[model samples]
Target: MQAKLRMVDAIIEVHDARVPLTGRNAYFEQNLLADTSKPHILVFNKSDLIDKKYRQPVENEMKSKDKKVHSIMWTDFKHKPMVAAADLIDIVKDSVTNMQRYNRDYRTEYNAMVIGIPNVGKSSLINAVRNRVLGKKGKATRVGDRPGVTMAVLNRITVHENPKIFLIDTPGILAPKAENIENAMKLALCQTVLETTLSESLIADYLLYYLNKRQLFEYVTEFQLKSPTDDIYELLFHIAKSRRLINKSDKDCKPNFSAAANFFIACFRSGRLKSDRFMDFDLLNKS
Candidate 1:
């Protein structure tokens, strides 16, 4: 990635909007952003999953925290009309043009490198911008629901024709530095890390703890619970029995708690537990 950085004109760092505070890659800060002249844009993807009301506040907080971020964008790659993608094109153009391009100022075309931790929509952003600018029908890069989809740095993809814009897609690079355990769990909760890296029950327990701490009990109604409970096993058992996820091999036909945990995690990921408006780092400063 450092080798490819020299050839690119700008940087687009994608992150999960739900985990804006903890989803960022520390490697980028220590390595990629070493050059202050580079135009770096921080894109908070999956913004649709979070409440829209917090958008401005989050932006303000990010700007105050990281002045190196030349621009900040909120995007949902799958959102129709794709206004964010198009607007991103404009921002990139202005950012690269206004900033010092090092030795590439004479170049007519713009090359931006899309980077982030796994599954934060780096490829999706590339595909969306490519489709929007070029009016292309298919994806310029591969996209998936899970992490580690793009395993390596890919060739430059053209997005626009005039002042021609191109995007370079890179594998999601996680920071190797040790992080706060709670913040790391937040990353897992937002699905930035692979699901298999942590046990489903463990992640589910953290989710329950987080939600309960926030006093957000919408999951109770979503899962048909009479009331909110602090116990992860009890919740999983209730969901398992309700959904009839049984251990058929067992003589007593016990509820499949593992399967139920997986289902619970899925519901949280899809934002079903919070009426499609969950934010992972809400009141982070206060907490």
Candidate 2:
């Protein structure tokens, strides 16, 4: 990743607006951005999932830290492609203008690198910018709902002409170990890391813990439960029964806890419940 940093003019760090300051790879500062004195802009994608009231605070809290965040913007790439594209270009231009150009000083064309954790809409955002800014109308890169979609770093692809802008899309990078268990669970819950990293039951347990702890209990009505409960087993059982997913063996019938848990987690992941919700950011809160 450090080797590639030299090839680009600026870096665009795309993170989920839902989990703005959590589960982000800590190495970005010490390695990529620090070693290379270039413009770095932070963009929060999936902005529609978060309430507008929280947007400024998220940026403010992040900026309060010691690290210099050139600029931050809230973007919903899918719905408002043109608006997001324009905002992205404007920020990049502003960042590049103020920073030392280094090797890129004499270059006529501009190259921007996109990096972030998995499934945070990196490829999708690239495509959105390309389609809108260049008047092109198709995906320049593959996009998926799951992690590791872009498994390797890619070469530069033209996003615009005239000033001639290109973007290099890199695979999502994650830390080897989380700062703590809650962060590890938050990353898994947000699907930034692989689902296989943790058991389905365990992720479901954390999901219930977070929702109930935060007092977001729409899940109760969603699962047809009388009230919220921390016991994941009890919750999944009711969810399975309510959804009519039952398993029967001879004379015995039982609720499918695995299926129910999978469904519950999938709902949260897919934003069926308006819940790509952020964790309570401890560092941001302290700042």
Candidate 3:
């Protein structure tokens, strides 16, 4: 990433809207931003999944903290047009033009690195901007529901023409160590890391705890539970039985707990469960 940093005119750090405060890679701030101080914008993707009320406050908090960041914008590529995907390119252009582009000041083409910590819609954001600006039909980059989809830093992808803009999509990189187990679980719940990296059951357990802590009990109705419960096993059993994710070959007819856990986590990720559709970070209480 450091090697390619010199080639780009700006930096675009894509992150999960659900976790505005948590699970962000600090390496980028320390190494990339502090060293070079390039024109940067923090794109909070998946804004659709999170509540809209937090937008202004989140933007304010982010801007106040990171003075190097030129702007902070939210984008939900899933629900296009509502949020102008083209705004990204405009922001990049304006920000780059305003700041010192170093050696690339005279260069007409704008190059930026789209980076984040796994599945925060880095590739999807690139595709949205590309399609919006170029009027292209297909994706310019590969994207997936899971994290670590883009395993390497890809070549420059043209997102805009005229005042030419190209984005370098890089793989999501998590910090070598998590600040705490809670933050680690938050990253897992958001699928910043692969499901296999952390056990499905463990992730689901954290999801349940998070929801219950926030008093978001819509999962009970969604899963057809009699009532909201703190017990992760109980919730999984209910989900398994209701969804018929159970083994019938055995006389006992035991529920597939692992499958149940995965389904529960998927429901949370896909915004199937109500209340807090997106797992929001309590920025006020953030450690």
The C-alpha stretches of model 1 lying farther than 4 A from their native spots are 275-283
What C-alpha lDDT does candidate 3 achieve relative to the native structure?
A: 0.82
C-alpha lDDT of residue 51 in model 1: 84
Residue clash pairs of candidate 2: none
lDDT of 1 by residue, 107-143 (tens): 8888899989999888888888887888888887898
- Candidate 3: how many backbone clashes? 0
Instruction: Give the count of colliding residue pairs in each prediction.
Output: 0, 0, 0
Error of 1 at 84 (Å): 1.9
Which candidate has the highest lDDT of all?
A: 1
Write down the worst ten-residue block by lDDT for model 1.
Answer: 275-284
| Global lDDT scores for all candidate models | 0.83, 0.82, 0.82
For each candidate, C-alpha RMSD in Å? 1.8, 2.0, 2.0
Stretches of candidate 2 off by over 4 Å are: 248-251, 274-276, 281-284
lDDT string, candidate 3, 77-150, tens digits: 77773255778888888876677766666688878898888898888888888888878888778989888788
Q: Assess the local accuracy of residue 148 in candidate 2 as a C-alpha lDDT between 0 and 100.
A: 91
Cα deviation at 23, candidate 2, in Å, is: 2.7
lDDT of 3 at 218: 88
